[model samples]
Target: MLDEVTFDIERGKIREFVLATHAGDTVHTSVEAARDAGFPDVPATATHVVVAGHYRDQRAFVAKLGLAYDRVVVGSVKWTYFRPLCAGDSVRGVRRVAADTRKRNLRFVTLETDYLDAAGDCAVRVREVLIERGAQ
Candidate 1:
């Protein structure tokens, strides 16, 4: 039971931070290459590492709730890459419930977050999908 569900059935569901990038986050050499390739910035794809981390975080939360694929009540994710974050740039991370829904025979949830750089510029937007697996 996610905390946001309006239904009278579930318990409070909370989101655990999945990933964050900050100053000192190791940037692979490939990121530098992309910047040099005239993309005006490091290839955004490399940032998937952050997303993967968050996914792992989410998985842990699900497990703690005794939920498996067939027991998900809702799921959704949305990510926004705002700008390039160079190496040595401090970044902040935060995550919270964005929205929740039960429809079309399925439950849907969105996890929203943002990463900000030392300069106070948004570097990345994180959106995660949480889907409800039928009760296990």
Candidate 2:
């Protein structure tokens, strides 16, 4: 056995994902998350669900990297809502590193993920932006 150990994560500094708009994914989940955070009246619809879940996912992603937050700015989410994610439904997504930019006071990492659904052979897409603060 080795007496010491070391690790590095610089190589995977960024990550992205794409998902599909699915049915059965009610907006309830998103509304609940928002309500739990002290906000109520969030539209509990499929469209809102994806947006809210996407944000939560983004935050989780940053937390996993042990990033410290001082300032964070999120870009708008552009997604197309479609059939619910249920039985016999199929979807596709693309996850990749988006952008890494820093201001004078802090460093920022922006990650974007897109999702599409199989509806009329047209895919609906959802783009999520996550900003990580103080990352150099």
Q: Which 10-residue window in model 1 sums to the lowest lDDT? A: 5-14
Residue-wise C-alpha lDDT for candidate 2, range 1-136, written one tens digit per residue: 1011111111111111112333232333344643564533222234432433433454554555445544566655665654333222334444445666657755555544444445434234455554544544
What's the CA error at residue 102 for candidate 2, in Å? 1.1
lDDT per residue for candidate 1 within 1-136, as digits (tens), equals 2222111100111011112333232222344554566543333333442533433465665664444755564344455677654433445565555666767655666776567666657677777777775553
lDDT of each: 0.47, 0.40
Give stretches of model 1 more than 4 Å off: 1-46, 49-70, 73-78
Pick out the ten consecutive residues of candidate 2 with the lowest summed lDDT.
9-18
Off by over 4 Å in 2: 1-60, 64-66, 69-73, 80-88, 116-122, 133-136
